[model samples]
Target: MAEEALFAGPAIRRLRKREGLTQAAIAARLEISPSYLNLIERNQRPISARVVMRLVEQFDFDPRTLREDEAIGGVEGLVRRFADERFADLGIDREEMQELLSAAPQAAAAFARLYDNAAPASLAADDPFAASRREIERWRNHFADLDVAAEELADEMRLSRGDMGLALVDRLRERHQLSVRILPQEVMPDSLRRLDLHARQVQLSEMLSAASRNFQLALLIAQLEQRDQIDAIAKGARFEDEAARGFFTRHLMGYFAGALIMPYGRFLRACEATGYDLPVLLRRFGVSFEQLAHRLTTLQRVGQRGLPFFMVRVDRAGQFSKTFVGASTARFVNSDVSCPLWHVHRAFERAGELQVQFVSLDVAGEREGGWLTMARTVEGRGEPGETQFVVAIGVEAVLAGELAQARGISLRSDDAQPIGPGCANCHRVRCSQRSLPPRGRKLHFDTIRRGVTPFELASS
Candidate 1:
């Protein structure tokens, strides 16, 4: 068995600083020598199990929160930020970066925030869609409040297979006095759904599949019945601008539609029984792949929690259409693009093929570990300009044992293939798969000495 990484030294030091406690005071509390605590804080020594227990016992700290706050993911973000072109002159090495992360995580995060604010007035001002994507990326693809609200509503509704669609249709007709109509393709050209507010009618394209029809109807029902709740949640988010708020409001409605289709309790039971097999869940629930994957990310009930999964949808050009993350430690940021080597990109090559891969991501010297991921390419027809995309779903490597597709895959953290978020933020040197040098790197021209790497990224 591999040893558990002790990566909470920085977190411990931060906790001490917040409490205004000295190294000596914390050392006495943990029953360790002051020098040992100092070493741990310096990233030269790992925090021992005894120290962790002493911390929990003395300070009433939740172990999970501590682990998450100190995870290598945070360090990875710092590595990405430091790799920006503006910081190239600093010449920060991996070891020094680790020391900085371990000793002063709060300060590290503060600097990252400052860099974010100081770098640009609006990161994607010209492109509203890109700006919204970046906004969701900032939240790390998870909205805890939205998840809770959807799950709670699902639990309350308890709609079974086929019942949800009928219920939603009935709710719209009875409560809202709206008529549901599936219009001919030509009549509904360039649109999948349209609401005639004056006529009190909901019109959908006849070309939509059964799953699509049900989802659209359910989305309308959600807007009518859950608008106030969704609005309250959106208002609480305090989005920087109206576009972000509107984008997130639409997202919340989609979450409501998904939860209505796959209620939390039953979905969790089916997921466990089927080992989260996408095909099995789709067959059983009569839902589309995208719907099933979206529902899976919402299995975060208090006691009956399922695997911590995240789902991403991308087009052929590496544009992110949707993303949701459930794992606290395993985060997927900036779904606009990920590592080109990711299986999701390959799945697009062989249309309708299912691809599985295990990938690791390391930034600076800290290894962020691997995840068990599955991707499938999907094609659909809509209006003349309809967009088709591929969807990828993943769970943390530790939960791979529970997945059937992961049966033969090695679960070792080190055995997995290495990947990065994207070229702009990635700092992995000499990666043959690397498309471009990270923002902060200098391109070195070696006319005499040519290495196997295509691009040379110089830190100096």
Candidate 2:
């Protein structure tokens, strides 16, 4: 490789920053020192092939992503090396250095660097979400490709044709002569695709509760029976690189996993049986509340859906780890998506209460412009104070009317008094709940806004 060969440092560094991590944080993820990390990031050191292998395994980076020709070169990589909190007044804080080194957090420091890197870019944009998105577009692209494939498969499988999942499943059983079994978590994980290779049966685990096990089992059977066909569909995509391709593969796999849990037809029945109530579905399907919420995102199996839905689960920080789009019409902002009035935050407010929400855009959607639909709350399963996830599900403008529960709700996306993504990204102009000024617009610097919403958005 040439001396100037790209080490993918910039790309990797950008990803870490977007996730709000630092070199020391990355080192912690790999159990190394910041000095060692500095050397590697600066290209003063080269990440051993061993470390590269570890990055893929640890962060789920595609091994190919590391093979690019970009130099660990740019000043950012150097910035990452010297970018210690101890020197922050000079853009790196001195006191924070000791903690960063000793405590060795996995991502906090890296996130700081990202702010330094993108802050200027963000300030230039009236819309921080658009800028933030540019920085992490790869992540979205990966999901986009997979989502496209999933949708196509959904269409071909005739998911929208009503009870299509069962019809396809039935056909597979008849043709492949495969048996389907549903076992509880106690008996078996949520599901498995048993493929015997050399007499070694592959046990694919779904980590589902009992009743959910049955629902997912049927889906897995359909996926398995069509495994080759699905693989072909995935391979047919026009991917940019192996790394991007691999991440998408994993995501699609997750979708299939979800489908198995809530096979189209039966799930639609359960949706009717329980009035599309997630809690009721969880109990009926014997799955976690999160699992039930996640499964709902896959309702695009064509004709069997109750209503088009988009599932979002987040914390107060506006960070989203799970996004399921069951309906095309409903869309979510990709960067800095925190909202207080949004059902997700409310879910956290009523942490354990299974409140059947009837929110329209005005009730929980953005409080400004566009059509929006939302449902939110923090749900519990294990013991108290054990890291329960705050969650919310929603439908965007295009499919807003398809909502089964949106009767007499806000008609516009921003009808619900909208909130901003944490103070970091929301552009809502006068939200009393402003956490921080939106990531972009200059702060008034007058009557200290002192709010949770971060933006000076258009509406109020």
Candidate 3:
């Protein structure tokens, strides 16, 4: 088999510009002629193994950049956006979209933002929760500075899973002169937590579990102590409104809370030791399954990175409540709807049991490959009647061999279930599970034949 050529022109050019080094200077350092380097930079010539090594040794370049699909996300996002009926007549192809993203990512992003802003009044532009979700996705759900600070604070506080709640309470009372009070459900009917500044009391609902109480305590600490750091990060995001900024800051505080409970270094080590077992980790961390799954998505510390994981939470009605893409290149992350065939939807039927499925997105060709998804139904935080949610986590199938969850499961494409982002964006015309035809494709209704799907899509 021929070795696949590495066409990393964009990455190389970006690195050169970022380092403020001329092509000729970098060429000289790599022991290559300027003309040859120019050819490599133009993607006419493949970069050699020796040059890759030289780049790593000289500039500490990440080898992953060599295979990075910088435009895949933008192209996929635009593909979905253009799938709308409004842009159906424009007839834009994937190649053109890819070129636009590759040439001017900022412009493409701005255009996407503009389109979002012009959306219907029902999809309010000032929706802070939506803005917070975007902000989380923008940072790939990892806040390095917050993680480091939380870890340091955890070290200083000497928190243990067994007595984490008590420890957090003591820290709050001693450090901030704030008392922790757990009130009955009736007393705080509408509120789970409330901070009375004058009384210096961090009141919590009695309905909250022990784990949730600890998390709330940690979140309060993050808000109070890490206010400056959180505010600085939110300011950098440049949100459109103050509400968005406030929500983003709250999310950062939550990130801090998770980090404090499960320190990155310790969590990563435990995950590796246990082959990324969620049940064991949940028990060890003294956190709910949802909390543990969320924490798994934030283990992206450089040099000590875990597998790039994506997490999503959805109700039985197919409403997505939370989504974090982490560093995965899965296109499904950008879509609002999930494929019905994915394990997440099935998790509702088999509540509490972990449902694992190997799925591949049926995009333009089978280019994105497969993913290993694990889902389980979790009890949502509520009072009288708790809302159940399916919390699902996924990683690229190629990287799932190391996970204990993938044991006895074949990661081969032949065995994997073919899925898509959603019925509207999916190109799987023959899919029986499709609820709606693809957005921009014309439907062919044949009286003579009935296929798996109600209508056959015209092949463009």
Candidate 4:
């Protein structure tokens, strides 16, 4: 097979700037003349296989770094925004999109940003709760260094789930002078767990199950013991404000709690042995369904990787509360709420049952690839009127054959149910469940020409 020519001039230039290297310096390292290197930087010539190998061996740069992963992300964002009917005049095919990403990446990104500023407000536009949720979703629900630190700490502890919970309680009492107490639901009111630093007490509601009690205990320990680590991670995040930083820290505390409950190496092995079986893993690890789902997404450790899964949590009213898309899959952006046709919405009608579906990711959806999805409703322990939430997790379609949930899913079938990212961005012509016309399209009221759907978008 012939070698594919590499035209990643922009990527190379960016790397050169990052490393403070001159064109002559990079050329000397690649064993090429300075003039030839200049031509490559201008994208006038494709990089040879020999030079690509030298760059990899000499500079320790990721192959993907040169492949323009950042540029691809921007291009994808543009593609989604451009799919809207309003952008019909600026039509470009997939090949042209590639050229734009390769030769004019900065221009492509500028266009994506411009479209974002010009796009109409989504459903969550003015809602404060939705705003907070979007901030959490922005992190993609996983932090590599935080996970690594938690894993190292867990390894040192070397305790089972039960023992780990006991250890946390002891550490709080002995080290922080904080005592654990289980209080009646009426006394605690709406709170499941509350920490009274002034009173030196950490209270847990009696309504919580054994697993939940353990989780709450672990979370309290994280807040007290892992405060420094959490703060450090938040500092590195460079959040826009103190409030966002606090939210990020709280999320990291939860991550530490989950990692404590299910240690990385052990949890990964269990995932493989069980074939990613949710119930069995839940029993073995003594964690809630939601905890297990969240933990599943963090098995991103180098060689001991588990299946890449994207997880989302939503309420009965169709508001997305939390989401995490794995690295291997296409990123989901803009709004966390999925298309109306997704099974996550259906989970609200049938509470407490696992709903599985095979879905195709198209122009209408936020994510860029196919998925094998599983969703289920979970009731939270709260006051009488408190709402329950549904948690849905999806893996790339290619991994379906190995998944226990995908046993009878027919991974090869092309009969996947069509779903968009959301109504605001979806442009599928025959979708009966569309809530609104796509942002860029003009609504046509053709009394003379009736179509299958309510609105027929004019072709570009």
Candidate 5:
């Protein structure tokens, strides 16, 4: 069988334009003729493996960008966007979507942004969190400046040498001239950590676990020390309002806190050395599983990058409480509704125990790729009673060989369960777990025989 061609014309053209290189200059660098390069840029000719390697070697380009560009403002994204009922009447097809992405990717991105802004008032109103998520996604949840600042502070305090919590508390006291006070739950019923600027004290509720206390301390330090940097980064985002900017700023502070507690260089080395053993990492960091999983998502530091892990925290009802997409191109990572078949939902059933699964995400009945996912339940900090959440982390299947958790798991194994973004966007008509039909697909009634699903989609 002939190998499928890789036609990444738009991506190559964008790269060339970004680098201010003409077709002839880029062709010279890639050892290809200007006419051939032009053909490739116009997508008239398929990009060869040799050219791909040359591009990677010459410009330090990520190979995935050539293939997975569709995940971000590409054809697949347009497909999902136009799948909405609002666009059903337009009847846009896949080929048209692909052409739009290929010819005018910037315009396509702007259209996607316009579509988002055109959402119903009920869903869009007072929803700064969505804007915050977009900003984080734009950065791929990695902030080098914040990580460097946090790592410097961590080293200065020698956090890894002794009790991390004690180190943070001492640093706060000595550096900021603030006293640390652990108040009883009755005294501070609602808040977890409160900074009393007037009293020059940082008060923490007794109900908080040791790990929580440490995290809170680190977060405070981030706010005090990294406020200027965080504000500047948040201001760079195209936030709709101050609420969105504030929400993004708070998330950045948390990112800084996570970095402080688990410095990037140290954490990446530990992760690689331990083969990403979660239990071992949890013990070493003195942090909760959720916190560790979240930290794993920020391991994308260019030259010393770790696995491109994606993290998501979902409640029992399947609502995403928090999510960070490091480098994985999996659309389901940011989907509003996740597939029911994913182990993320099943993790609730086996609380505290890690549930691992190899899942294949499908789009429009076509397989996108495989992923190795792990999920476990974590207790949430809610008022009155503690709420439970499932925190899940996943890396692409190709990188699973590097993880200790993926031992004994074969990527080629047929046991890999097929999943989708969710019932709404998924066109897997035969999925037994599908709760609803796909958004744009019409239902076909089969009175004679019932299929795997209750409703069958018509083959248009």
Candidate 6:
């Protein structure tokens, strides 16, 4: 019964405490008497709809929790409340029950619904997407600036070119005092790691496949070995999405793996040594092309991070496998939207035919920008499996040097296509192929003329 309050009196009291406001303070803000506000907060007088709205606006509390009492089961709470034997003995009192429900309103209904949610009944359960989303968000914030860490680490470890895998192992043992091993896959059983931080020793079975092996070992070393450093960098980053936070977390584990496998300074020199050729680096390092590509995105630490590139890897169908950005790439402001008319689709037709293209981007509250895009298709999995076109999408401002090195075709400045992985989330203006309007904007149509884009910016 205590938990059943739609806005529970106790929760309101707690909210006041959290904000460090007395009843009088909130009452003044609401232009209500302190005594009246106290009554509503205590569940003595039911909250008015106006107060519910005001709580949402003032405190920025989740509307769903605020309306929990007004939800579907809340009305039934009031019905059951006065459903005494004497009232029921009066026989058919359906109209009376309705009147009682009307008096209780959203509070009763919301309480009932929330009660049903918390109930251990077999059939009904609330979906936990929100919790999962939050976890994912936390992870993203955890590893937002891995590239910076990797770059700064290059000098501290005294690593200069050569085999990154071997050199990183030597440094980890000497500098971090963490033991490194390359156990054969068959040697260890089910367990991946056995850590004793007091002893500062971690033994991981090399039983993991190529990607998994590198990933697990590096993450363990990062967390147990350099937790404070990683956490410090992550704590300072400002994240926009919850899933991005989770992504940052999951990706950081991998970032540590990359740092371990291909230490920054050595890897940067290797990129220059091999001229950023994906296959050459893979054959030399025995890592997957995808892993190498992921490393390219994290090249932004101090003086040594390679070209500050906005590394986006998408296949023929416009599926993004990985996305990374450096400080220089961050400065390449985006047009709150994207265009789909770009020639990336042709890469699917002309598989393996490397193509250079030009695109225009308009940043909101700013002017347009230019970019050079490099796109190509690569075979995926094995021979029988379908060939894939992995396009390395990037901007022109950051590409002058790379363009000069690999000059196949000049990127024309006049062909004003815009960048877009897909239309549903794009924010470009006047795009004929726009399937949806940019998020956070109201789409309005005018009687005089229809815009090329399906949705037009609404005016004040």
User: Best by lDDT, which number?
Assistant: 5
Off by over 4 Å in 3: 1-127, 197-199, 364-367, 383-387
lDDT of 2 by residue, 1-460 (tens): 1111223454456557766888888888877788887766654565654464356446635433342211121222233445445545676543554344323322434544465556465454544333333322333223333344444555555553235335445545565554444333454433344554444333434343344434354445435544665566456655545554554455456556455444556677778665565556665545556666666655433223344445666766667765554332233333346556555555566656643343322211223223344444543333334445665665433334334454555454233444444555444445666665543344444356554443444321
lDDT of 1 by residue, 1-460 (tens): 2323455666777789878999999899889999988888776786654565577557734333344423334665666567777779989866877666656665666676677667565665655555555555445444556555666755555556657667667768877899888899889878989999899999999888778888898788789778998888677664567877788788778877777777666777888888888888887777888888888766655445566577888888776777676443444444357888788888877776779898767664446656788888765675432437888888766546658788778777777777777776676767777766676556787889986676776654
Per-model CA lDDT versus the true structure? 0.70, 0.47, 0.79, 0.70, 0.80, 0.52
Q: Compare candidates 5 and 6 on TM-score and give the better one.
A: 5
Model 2 scores a TM of 0.46
For model 2, the local distance difference test gives 0.47
What local lDDT score does residue 135 receive in model 4, on the 0 to 100 scale?
52
- Residue 162 of model 3 has an lDDT of 84
**TM-score of predicted structure 1:** 0.77
Q: What TM-score does prediction 5 earn?
A: 0.80
Question: What ranges in model 4 sit over 4 Å off?
Answer: 1-114, 117-140, 155-157, 162-164, 197-199, 328-336, 364-368, 383-387
The estimated TM-scores of all candidates read 0.77, 0.46, 0.78, 0.74, 0.80, 0.46
Q: C-alpha displacement of 191 in model 4, angstroms?
A: 2.0
- Tens digit per residue, CA lDDT, model 3, 121-198: 356556778877778877878899999999999999998888898889999999999998999888998888999989
User: Regarding lDDT, does 2 or 5 come out ahead?
Assistant: 5
lDDT of 6 by residue, 119-148 (tens): 444322122323332343333222335544
Residue 171 error for model 6, in Å? Answer: 10
> For candidate 4, lDDT tens digit of each residue in 136-186?
545545566667766776776665755766776776788789898999878
Could you tell me the lDDT of residue 304 within candidate 3? 72
Error of 4 at 213 (Å): 1.5
